[model samples]
Target: MNKFHGIFKQLFELQLPGTEALDLYEGYYAQLYEALTSRDNYDIPIVMEQARITGGPVLELASGTARIVKHIANAGYSVTGVDISDDMLAIARKKTEMLPQRIKKNITLHKGNMIDFQVDEQFALVILTATSISLLKDEEEVECMFNNIYEHVKDGGRFVFDLLDDESFENSSLRMGGIDAITLNQSPIPKQFILMGEQRDANHSKRALMNFYSEVIAEDRTYRFFGSTEKTYFQYDAILPIIKKTGFKIIQIEKKELAKNEMIYMFVLEK
Candidate 1:
């Protein structure tokens, strides 16, 4: 029976929804996303700390699952989270339902594209963390996003975000592999996942193809595999001009080492 159940599970996960342009995190995958990322994303507290220093109403673009937005709201800032994924927004709303009234009242989630979103009021602090700015497919898209971010910020307000440094990606291996575990609702039945991937430069563009295969193993030792391929392009020199053209003045750009083999670039911009 366990063998049969595993087979069914594999088939289900194999059919999970995704597109060349976007990955749809719904149903079982939604649960998996929550399980994988519910922990303190070090970026959350970092952004929250900045928000406290800068003051708010704050805005977070591509705010997946409200992980960071929730922290800002709970820290007593009014925050708005915007994303294009209904599945992600659904999970965020469900989680918000359990928050205290004060915190719940402080957070607002909107379904919109980051390149073209509008709000009634401007914010003192705007952020896009966790390398989400890489999701824009090209320079034109990045310009549009920066323009929107510019319009959303109050004069002298700060815009904060993180991205992969060009040197890190240029020096990275073409292929890599890793393993991680996802514990569902703190249940003992942990799901082990593996990632194996390669990166290749895209033709005539600074963008590159990030292709990967992922396998998730169930408690019964049954497993499923999912594949993803996306375009990512962000270089400090390439992006800085766009930010300046969109009316942002660079305040600081710093490199932080997270691990022996991993590093990130943080940007602070002012309008």
Candidate 2:
């Protein structure tokens, strides 16, 4: 990766451990939910609605912010949410506080690695929502993670996940464009944040590099962001074969016709 990409990745991956990642997310959690949920014809609710099918134990892998977990819990289902980032979980725990008493009692939270979270009891339904399953760093990790999910789900139970179809990326690649400059002044520690540049090709993949230069006024410390490309690109076609080899079956798909750019498909596999 180029210097800009490397720096972008570092900022996202490392600063979250010590900086305003958790605090910033906690502050804006509800607002983020409202903006994302209000978008018309989103399929997340469809997956959350499906979680009610058995009313049995439901485990959401990589459950960031727990927005769906809160909804599933409120609907009277036993839910357990697990995520890799403590920063994310911190915000998620705070959000769960808004849930009703009975639902709050039914929901449990665990912090662990997504590819290898250990649990004795099998769940009736296993879900990885909001394109989280695609976050695995590579194809090998993806296969292993899916295998792990397969092991955790009970027989006949379903594994649900959503992704933007590859064709969407293919189409968008042609429109490959850059972002306008915008300042994010939310951090107590000032950051010079910019979407430096982007490279989206016609075939399938797109790459965008973001830069964050933070100065912590109180601590007299300055650290360069460790990560690069806040938004990485992927081809859904490249991901599907890996999903199939991991023994998953595609059961239902929700294609957004209004905005083809926002197509989200749900993959359900029976174990």
lDDT of each: 0.70, 0.62
Q: Which stretches of candidate 2 lie over 4 Å from their true place?
A: 3-41, 169-171, 174-177, 180-234, 257-260
Q: Lowest summed-lDDT stretch of 10 residues in model 1?
A: 1-10
lDDT of 1 at 113: 90
lDDT of 2 at 117: 94
Residues forming the 10-long window of minimal summed lDDT in candidate 2: 22-31
lDDT by residue for model 1 (1-271), tens: 1111222234444565431112435444555566667774657656766787789899999887888888898989999999887888998999998999999999999998988988888999999976777777888988988888888899889999888775675325432322223333344336544343434443434454443233444555544444343546477788878887898998877777654344678888988
TM-score of 1: 0.79
Error of 2 at 243 (Å): 3.4
Clashing pairs in 1: none
TM-score for each predicted model, relative to the true structure? 0.79, 0.70
After superposition, candidate 1 runs with Cα above 4 Å error: 1-27, 169-171, 174-192, 202-205, 211-225
